[model samples]
Target: MHIAYFPELALLFADIRFPQDQSPNNASIHLTWRPPHGEAKELDVPLLPDTTSLERIEVTMHSSPTSAYKMGETHNKWLSTCLGYDTVLAYLGENERPVLMSTHQKSNQPQIQQGGGWLSSITSKLPTSLGTIISGDTEPDDKITFADCAPFLVVNEASLHDVSRRLPESEEMDISKFRPNIIVSGAESCWEEDYWSELQTSSGVKLHLVQNCVRCVSLNIDYATGKPGEGESGKVLKKLQSDRRVDKGSKYSPVFGRYAFLGKGDEGKSLAVGDEVTITKRNAERTTFDWPGISSTPLPTAS
Candidate 1:
């Protein structure tokens, strides 16, 4: 589950970054945390050593239920103290979870199964134009991290600007509230991304637009105070409800951005900042967002 489940997490500022000079496989990544009312601290969590044993735990996501490896007690204790609860940090070790097929995927498309060692052999036979063949040890095209729905959530800067324009004079919307993985600019108009079916970056990485991401109450949380906002700030979701409830699949929650997954041949590729994104495919009509797990039931209306 996302930290949004515990609204207090909004107040926790964590700076997690990878070392620029080292390959990700060998980089020493660290997390610096600034709690609402405490000394800023750094969490030194090393990669799971081969000798360290991890407990397999089950975690439920919006799209499906999957398993993950629970981290050690020290890290869990630190996070639990920050959140004022007993919290366990779960790590999605490689191959621990498979990306579940979504309704947005075409029925006729080939379904990538988990632990399919066949991908390595198939990838080697493909033309080099498709990109380097990824080894089976690395994440397969069908695998995902602990993402809520899709591997990526893409938002248009123009659409965010439009939302800011609609806010009260004293209140401006921030991209952090939406929690998008990619922020795209250069759109001809606001919400133009709704019609985009596929996008390719200048670097050749491609993403297939899936469902429209549904808005949740977490958007109203004030990151500064770690509590629900006041006045107009708290009503961002309500404001969007007027015109953003366009996705019939998730009727109560307004849609803001598009959920996406990496295109088949673009896996194991890196997308740098400022990469020019081009729409490679367009939907003739706006996609009707559908996810039976969450959309099939009614959601609580945002206050």
Candidate 2:
């Protein structure tokens, strides 16, 4: 379920907060929304296994492939009514979807071997390789829920500020539109994250920076109206396409943020706002953004 294909989904707001006394043994999410010309509705959906038979569905993406459990008729009916169309909610259980192999330190074996000494030692300290990091002969414990590509998408505040400066004065760009899982500030220049290979937080959580995140038409969506904007807001992607297509992989889409995954021993670690981020490793050259499952296509140069 992506806003680019189903714009109406933007109208639905999910309250992911759990009750203070909620336990993993009994978990659920509460959803509240009011359809157009309809009364407000709310539902507390149980996360535990139910008697309703679920359909297993194959979910394919540019980065990797996975499976999801599609909810039965009752849950689907409630969600469909809110969206004003027939739809189904899918759930990807823990460890169901592995993080992309390209994002793992083990995937850069050739570079580590060539560099030797320090470079190899640093990565050696990281988690052991998880086979292909997807469906392969071995199943991986390091997994993500339902992110598009990587487990985390990190954006630099300075880079976002640069983007705002490029936009027309009448147009405004919000960081929420980019949907980054983490935002780092105090960067000296815009787009400096392109060279970052790894980051460590003040609390010792480390992230292996993988690839540049590709932009899409969803950037032009106006959350207020749940529709694509017709003004400068609609041209946000076009504006980024003018210069942000630096990655050789996925060249057709503009790059704004870096996709990343947690490093060794950082699983289940907690991160909060205002945490200081330190760039632990940086590439001498910008990453070309290559992945095993993704195909790249060239795009016309901006006029």
lDDT of 1 by residue, 1-303 (tens): 464567777655544344676344544436555666778666766544232588888887764567777888988998887777898977766533454435255544333222211111010111223222222222223555566666567888889888998888876798888887688877778887776777777776766776788888888888877788888888888889989888777788888988776666565676666667777666655666655557755433559
Q: How close is candidate 2 to the true structure, as a TM-score?
A: 0.78
lDDT of 2 at 40: 66
Model 2: per-residue Cα lDDT at residue 53: 72
lDDT of residue 275 for candidate 1: 65
User: Cα lDDT of model 1 overall?
Assistant: 0.66
Candidate 1, superposed: residue stretches over 4 Å from native: 17-29, 47-51, 96-141, 297-303
| Model 2 weakest 10-residue run by lDDT | 118-127
Query: Among these predicted structures, which one has the highest TM-score?
Result: 1
lDDT by residue for model 2 over 1-303, one digit each (tens)? 789977666666665444578554466777776444457678777765453477788776654558877877777899888887888777765325655445543444333211212211121112123222322211244455576766677888788887888778866587878887678877768898887777776666767776778788999887766788778877889999999888777777788988877676554565666666777777665666655445363322559
